[model samples]
Target: MTRPLRLDALAYGGDYNPDQWPEEVWHEDVRLMREAGVNLVSLPVFSWPQLEVAPGVYDWAWLDRVIEVLWAGGIRIDLATATATPPAWLVRSHPEMLPSDSDGRRLEFGSRQAYCPSSPVWRANVARMARAMADRYGEHPAVVLWHVSNEYGDHVARCWCPESAAHFRRWLEDRYGDLDGLNEAWGVNVWGQRYTAWEQIEPPRRATGPVNPTQLLDFERFSSDALLELFRIEVDVLREVTPDLPVTTNFMSLLRDLDYWRFAEIEDLVTDDAYPDPADPRAHVPAALNYGLMRSLKGGRPWLLLEQAASAVSWRDVNVPKAPGRMRIDSLQAVAHGSDGAMFFQWRQARYGQEKFHSAMLGHRGEQSRTFRETAAFGRELQRLAPVKGTRVRSRVALVVDWDSWWGSSATESLPSQRLGWLAQARAWHAALHALGHAVDTVRATGPFHGYDLVVVPNLYIADAAQAAALEAFVASGGSVVVGPFSGVVDATEKVHPGGAPGPLRGLLGIEVDEPWPVPDGAAELVELDGERFDAPVWSEWIEASGEASVVARYATGVLAGRPAVTRRAHGAGVAWYVSAALAEGGLVAVMRRALADAGLPARTRIDPDVEAVTRADDETDYTFVLNHGAREVAVDVPEGAEDLLGGDATTGRLVLAPLGVAVLATPRAAEPPFVTLSETTD
Candidate 1:
């Protein structure tokens, strides 16, 4: 089993920016935090301009005092690198650092994610600042973790400038190697995109007619890599001084700017920022799935809920306040999926900024507000459930989520129709897994695959040889895997992989694809499974069985109607299942449930349907967190008589839970291993 972090229990409290207020207010903030049982404070997130007033000049008087005060108050610190927003001086002096949109227009200062990732000057300045900060605070007793550049992503296309364009050319050369290879890979012959010379290529610009989708896709990948390298620059600098401290950048949920699966391997820990709509019915399910993705990215490692709204967020067009008990319910949902800590965006509401109206532990009118009382109560409950706080949750199911394939599938210029995007299919499968209560992890083709009992690859269009070999090895070792529609069509270079449709995976899945029907938006086909017909939409791949595999489900109507829509083949001690049609949520769940059962990886907890339950275990005990997301009260059957960690009530059979009610049950303590122990310390 993988080792756990040194956290004692669930770390509570959140973003505390005393710099935004007067020094006299610090004591009152401390009092509120203490009352709320706040143990962790993420500090100095947006204080770069104040810290470094000019080039090569430093001022730590305010920061040092703040850290010392918080430490004295018994609160640990998660120190930020303070590189999110560059100072006005830097932007004024180096205008090249500013990002440009796809239309080739440079953005002005004012917004927070405005820096160009490919700028060497920006990277150098950030790296220098990071090293200096780490050197000053790495030895502090209260410092437990390093928060590298917060939420790095591109809100607009950048690097259309001469320097960035030059760098893009170099990146292309490194990736495609030579002009001939680049031409063939991008299929330049079809649309006059072929380059006779390296310098002739430029980053995709809006003026470029109907911008070739495949080329644009590669450009996006390049940009993500550039930003990831920027993150690495700061991480490297911090590691030089604080070698043992864990480093992480807060990831935005489903933002689509960067492929999180690739970045997960580089960061020491994966922490995500989630702000789901309180009224959206599918909100909690997607939140749970995203948390699972973070955990799986780190190989079943515990992650943190870096920034959530204590009440309501300030970014949306209509900021709806979370209903009664919804905040606590959402926090517990994070823990249920494997979060080691819960934190909010701000400790106190901002006074003069875009986020002035955002909810916090302490409102603008001091600690007299109801939000403060609710936050304190939640913190107290977290402290009470200390035993199961730091436990690690594991999963046997893996789902492949690849950025290259997602880009490739979306960029397809032709096919029968246009509605078969990769994200849609991935979300459909994700929803299916969530409905089934399977703790699913999102894995990339490059990640480790040895221990998982089942693996699902949905719309894996861009398949590489190495990844195909890994899947083969995994199946050979008795692990079952699923490969779905539009999979294995293209190689790493975005070109068709030549042998047949299903390309590299054809031999392993034991199927040869004859053609793929890209059904228009809202068009669907019915597939029969277990004598029940279900709707499968977006696209259908017509296939002919090769070796041992046979059809499991088939299309209901078409010229090639009644053909296979889903198939399975035995390989070694396991099986490889293929879905030729994009199955709906209900059908996908039914299909995956059967797959999990065959792999002996079905959900262990009793099904309540509406009452979502997830269990986490450590060396000492197992904790089951039950959440009632339904409107009416539901009776939850207890695994064994146990005490409710939130309320000291000992709950037995027929426990009635109100809407959005959360319950944490601690199972009887397991025999402690010789080297295992529990502590109350948190960072």
Candidate 2:
């Protein structure tokens, strides 16, 4: 197999839509970008309207000029397909291409991503434009990568129009193979849902008898698959022309409308558009978690921070600017969490439209703004630390991110509470991993399972026989694993897997779940971890020990009081931990920390808890990134002697880092300690 692309250091810069502005302003934009140390620009992203002003007609004059200007300024271009949204003419000409919502209302074509993915008309037009764009610009020296489409989740769900209904039936036939298999899988007998003909199956809708939970879940899976097929169509066209150039679509972090894990498998590279509110205390955790997920899905390959607000996002109800130094701090946080590049949603502010008020390095007022100055300062720093790019950030921990399980668990209508969703649990687990600074990758069960010292499957509600066997073998072979609550409840068909709860993982975890004791909506239970007790609530499952696994933590109060909330069993050289309840953030963090340490994949000691740290290695040297995510100043104790990339200062014992500050330290290969080296490759 061919190895993935390796970036030299974290690439800098962000989305640039010079097509929205006058040609006269292009040079100043390039100059400002160069001064800010911007090396990459995601060009012509929402330019479909400009590209195809009329049917079968094309305009490349404006785009050609912008690409030439950026390339002249020494910036690599991540060229977009300019088909995020079909032009107004296409929508007006082919009204059948428009999507209908779950309520049976046809959507209008004002916002982006409004076209129906399953529409033959939309697909053909998008492919035609994509081929034309690539044919004209594939070999351009300035084009480093191709972005197939913008964030792909919008208009992905609730398509009930005739085209979608026909496509949905075809998708079901392909998945189940026949009507008998489909009936058994969906448990159609339960509520007269059994279908003698495939045409009877409709996309899950509220009007469809409040929709069976199992059918609803299957529809979600089918919807994601449908969207994936659309994305594949665009990707196929792009790859046919530019086989050497990498291709990707920007993913929205923690989005539910599409399965990102599936997308990671098809795209040459993975990129995410993350915009976290600085005011939210847990904002940093999502960014870190996303980095880990991206790295995991790509199997240690560097992913890009494709689109972040340079300052604040105007899309929110209350747009708040990131406090002083927060943008720089967050950018370094991206690098610390394994991002190969850091780029914003825009380089310059838009003059009109929804994103017009969004933050940018150069606002409408131009280069005289503070955002521009700070952006330039950070850009220069990235250039100085260019040597760190393409270096590998290794970790022994792995998180199993299953879209099937996520959909099945979240779509269950009779669950304890809608608030106890699978996405919430996944985010919780992700946040815990980020807090510990572990380099985590989100891997599918079918993917290679070797090399990870510890594997965590949070709320894996659905599993196939093959995946179940893989988990068993992984644990038996001395790899530690953690299975969170609600895992192993259903089979691939979304039906209860029978035998016992956590049907497949029961034997591996040495526990058989007897019944799930649902916690009242507003109630909570306490559990002791280490010494101090922590409060946890939501859903709790009661399990009877059938093997040698020992209970570690128990509920403090309840009818099933003293029951195991957390359990562990030794399978071979490694162990498997089963968490049977929703744990608070503090408790979850502590549990993962102990499990990771027990597996010989402990967190780094040199870095402070508040100081996010990560190490990337090249053929010769290793670059350690230390970023202060806290507000107050932190004194970091460095080795006897080391060179700082930002200040060019020699650091010894105590280095003070200001609020939202960052430091890139270079350490010689021979001088590194044994622990740091072992930790990076524990698996």
Candidate 3:
């Protein structure tokens, strides 16, 4: 198989819409882009209306001039297919192309991505647009990447329209063969919902009571595939026309609507648009997790930060701008996490549109804006840190991220507790691991567990037999594992495993779950670990220890007192830990620290709440990124014989970081301790 795409130098720029401005303003945009040391920009992302004009008629003169101007200014283009949104004329003629919500009301086409994924009309038009763009710019000197379409499923993830219903039925037929197989998979016999014919099936539309959980699960799977199918249509056209150029579409980080694992597998490269809320102090924790997933999507290949707000975003109720140095640190955070470079949503803030108020590289006041000054400085910093490109971030730890489990655990109805959300648990566990200073890479449940000492399963609500066996093999091979609650509950069909919770993993974890005992709302529960009390809220399980499993922590308060809130089992040469309660941050950290020790990894002595430390390495040198996200200035210990790349000075120890300050230290690879290499192959 061909490898994912990579850039020679650090990519630096944002979405550029020369079409949004006057012809004369295009010159100024390029001029400022050069001053900021910008080298790449994604263009004409939402230019379907401008390019197509009406029906088959075209308007290429304007786009030709824009590309010529960028090429003349020495800026590379991530040229879009200009199919993000369809022209008004097409939507007018084919109103049936518009999407419908779950309620089955046809949505209007006023905003972007307003078309149904299953619409043949929309697919044909987009494919045509992709071919046109590739035929025109496939060999253009300025074009480096072929941006497929804008973020898929950003606005319309799923459609309940008649066309979508038809597509879903077709997909179901292929997935489960005939009626008997479908009946068995969905267990439709429960409520007299078994289908006699394929035509009887429809998209899971509005229903009086809770919809069949299995039906809902299938619908979610089908919806993700529908969007992926749309992407494939455009990708097939692009690759055929421009076989040499790499193609990609921006992914909304950790988006629930689509399975990015499948999407990334087909695309030539992975990219993401991340907007961690400025209002939340700890937003970066989850942002790191998202970035990890992006990098892991292509097996640790460097992805791009395709879009991030330069400052305040217009969509939030309270649009908070980034603090003085926050933008620089935020951009570097992406670099630290394995992004080749940073790019924003728009090169210039829109003068008039839904996103006009969104902050950009150039604001309304142009260069005089604070946003521009900070971003320009950051762009220069990116130039100085260019060598950091193409380097991989090494981690001995892996976290399981499964889309099926996310859908199963967060099913709108029939969940044991709505609070046991997949993302919430993922972020919570990742935060503790982050606090403990382990560079975490995300993995699928059925992992290629090579080159890692520890694997963590935050929650695996839909663990199948294969996934269980994979984890079992990992542990038997002497890799320590830490599993959180709500795992191994169901099979691929959403049917409960023959046994209770942790079904397939019962043998590996050495425990059988009697029942899930969720803590009541507004109630308090505590657990004792190592003779220290800690809050264990939201969830707990009635776990019966089988075999030689040992209880590591017990419920000190609540009705389930003295029961196992945490258990550990020695399997083969490795250890398996089960955390049955949704332990508070402190409690989770305590459990994680123990797991780290068991895996022969040293837990950091002190973890700063607002500081992040990450290392990226090439063959001969290690680049350590230390960033301070807190308000107060603090000093950090630097590795011996390290040179500060940003400061252009040699520093040995005691590197002080101002609030939001960042430092990149270069040290000889041999000087650092022996590192475990991550194998690219999957188990």
Candidate 4:
């Protein structure tokens, strides 16, 4: 579990672009902030060009006044260093800092994140700017957090150029120590492509023949590390100047290019920017999954929902307003998952700009409209539930998050098929646990796994012997595991493991796979679990038990009909299960529920499908948040003696929730805290 924000309760409000308006309008903005219970506002996100008008020079006059005004109005400020967008002067002077795409075309500097992450010139300039910002505002009373570069690697995730090639070579040398090791790992001898010198290697850029799998994987890793290095330079400066203020950069959730597991470790707090389209039917599922992963990034600590659309967003082809109360419900959902703060992208809608159509707490009409009223109401609700602050969600389930597997499967050409889902397959497994009402953490498959009773590794395509050993030991020590198909098929170097597939942990699974059969481009098949038939249209493998593994499910039809589709083996004190195909949504849910039962983990709360139930606990109470995302009313059977926080009354049974409605049930705890942690207080 996690804890509170800057003050006694949840922090609110978001990006405030006071520079866009005149100084006379500043007082009115502050007045509106106070009325809406705005507590925190991030400042100067895209202000690099404005901050540095000339080379090696900065103008901080407007930012200083804005911070002072917000502080006088009793609002905390999340100070951004304003390096997300580089100044045109800097880019124009050093054109080498501009990033090139995979096609070798240099992208122009009219947009944000224009500087190449691997460019040394860009890094040095960004460092000076970060230091200047930190020195000027380090001691400000209103600033409680330092916001690093906004959403690293969002637009320019990869840069392919001669400079990038040099950086990639250095990164590889650091990892493998020598050219011989790189040759061996990449298996360059296979295509008469052995490297004799350090300069012989280049990034996987614009190739006619298939690029080396390991080369492609290494390039992805290098790009992620390059972004990390850029962010760390700013983080180091902030720690030196504002040592006590928490530092964080908002992560765009599930960004495939940047490695979040690596980025999360270097920051003081983890925060994410989520803008799920209200019109998509599967929007909330991904949002929920990302929230769980974001919370887990800091060890299930209290993270913040740094940005969300109060109504509609600008970038999408279609911008749809959030149905009434949907914003409130989703905001609270972030809290239920483990957010200590709820914020949006903009406090006020911009009059003219790229994101002018983006919705904000105070739209163009100001605070006299529905958006402002809803924002104010949500603020008041956060104030009422202040007691729930500083609490965390507890869970015994963990889902494996492996970046190497992600790159190995998607960035390379060795995938069984182009349609073989990478991260989607992984998130599908999480969706199953979520559907069953169990809290789950997404953690690294190669890292230390602890305090988790059940670990689910979905599509972990790349696993070394050491990783396999760790999983074996975990299962041997009374921890249940559910392994997905196509896992443990290769090593970290993108080389297929010797012997059959699932090389290292094959014995733990007690089964051997013959070959994987991908569903035809336009076909689907069925598998039978117990007595129920389920469609599986992804990939299936032929499996035969080696020792003690028993078949759990089998393909009902096909040339290899009646073959084992799923298997389970009883290890020393725990059980290891495996799913050998991409099952339908319901099939995945059924398998996961059975796996949870095998691990003795029960649902936190049983409710309707569209209603989400999550519990968070503090020193005294277990706060259950039930939110109905459906369009119709749903009845929830209330537990005895539970008091409804919204109604301020004790409820006995049968509470009906209208569409987009929410209810908080507080139940007293008599035992010790649910899950033990490193600290009792977030302070």
Candidate 3: residue pairs that collide: 448-682, 448-683
Tens-digit lDDT track for model 1 on 425-533?
A: 7777877766666666778775578668888888788888888888888887888888888888878766677966688887779998898876667677788888888
Top TM-score model? 3
Pick out the ten consecutive residues of candidate 3 with the lowest summed lDDT. 674-683
Clashes of each: 0, 7, 2, 3
Clash list (residue pairs), candidate 4: 1-392, 2-392, 3-390
How well is each residue in 367-456 modelled by candidate 2, as lDDT tens digits? 777788888888877777677666667566778878777777777566646656777787788667766666566778654778788888
CA displacement after TM-score superposition, residue 633 of candidate 3 (Å): 1.5
Of candidate 2, the 10-residue stretch with the lowest lDDT total is 674-683
Worst 10 residues of 1 by lDDT: 673-682
- Ordered from best to worst TM-score, the candidate numbers read 3, 4, 2, 1
Residue 565's lDDT within candidate 3 is 88
Whole-model alpha-carbon lDDT for candidate 4: 0.83
Q: What is the C-alpha lDDT of each candidate?
A: 0.78, 0.78, 0.87, 0.83
Model 1 scores what on Cα lDDT? 0.78
Task: Indicate the residue-level lDDT of 230 in model 1.
Answer: 86
